[model samples]
Target: DQQVKQNSPSLSVQEGRISILNCDYTNSMFDYFLWYKKYPAEGPTFLISISSIKDKNEDGRFTVFLNKSAKHLSLHIVPSQPGDSAVYFCAASGYTNAGKSTFGDGTTLTVKP
Candidate 1:
């Protein structure tokens, strides 16, 4: 079973608007969650992250929220710009995994001008 899933394969938003990306996990052991942004022909870059102990984390225009009880998490980007358009991947890791992470298939986000 896929432990991490991004049910929506894609999302679209206009520039200067809010973009929300959702993720779900089936593994209760996951204690850390992360979001990565990937551009074409380049590696994924870390965006924002949240620890299971915390419900929310924010960095600049990006924020990540974790709902431990629901085994769900979301990434929010406000005032999204065209440069923010990319494929976003959600990943989860447990202490026992030795730093290995389970990644979602990814959701392509398009920011329109």
Candidate 2:
């Protein structure tokens, strides 16, 4: 069974709206959660991240929330722009696992202009 999963294959939103992507994980060892955004032909870029010790982390227009009790996490993009259209992936890893992560398939977000 997959350790991490993003149920929504895709999402569409109007410009300046909020887009929320959800992720669920089955592993309890995950202590760090990360969100990455990827564009065609480009490597995934790190967005925001949250530690199991904190409930949320935000950077500019992006925000990541984690719920350890539920083994779930969500990413929120406020004022979503067309340029934000891309595939978002949720990743989980332990402190000792540093560079290694258990990643969700990915959620494609289409932000219309």
Candidate lDDT values, in order: 0.94, 0.94
Candidate number achieving the greatest TM-score relative to the actual structure: 2
**What does the lDDT read for residue 46 in candidate 1?**
88
lDDT for 75 in candidate 2 is 97
Prediction 1 global C-alpha lDDT: 0.94
User: How well does each candidate superpose onto the true structure, as a TM-score?
Assistant: 0.96, 0.97
The Cα RMSD in angstroms, rounded to one decimal, for candidate 2 relative to the true structure is 0.7
User: Which stretches in model 1 have alpha-carbon errors above 4 Å?
Assistant: 96-98
What residue pairs are clashing in model 2? none
Question: Per-residue lDDT of 1-113 in model 2, one digit per residue for the tens?
Answer: 99999999999999999999999999998999999899999999988888899999889999898889999999999989999999999999997774699899999999999
Lowest lDDT block of 10, candidate 1: 94-103
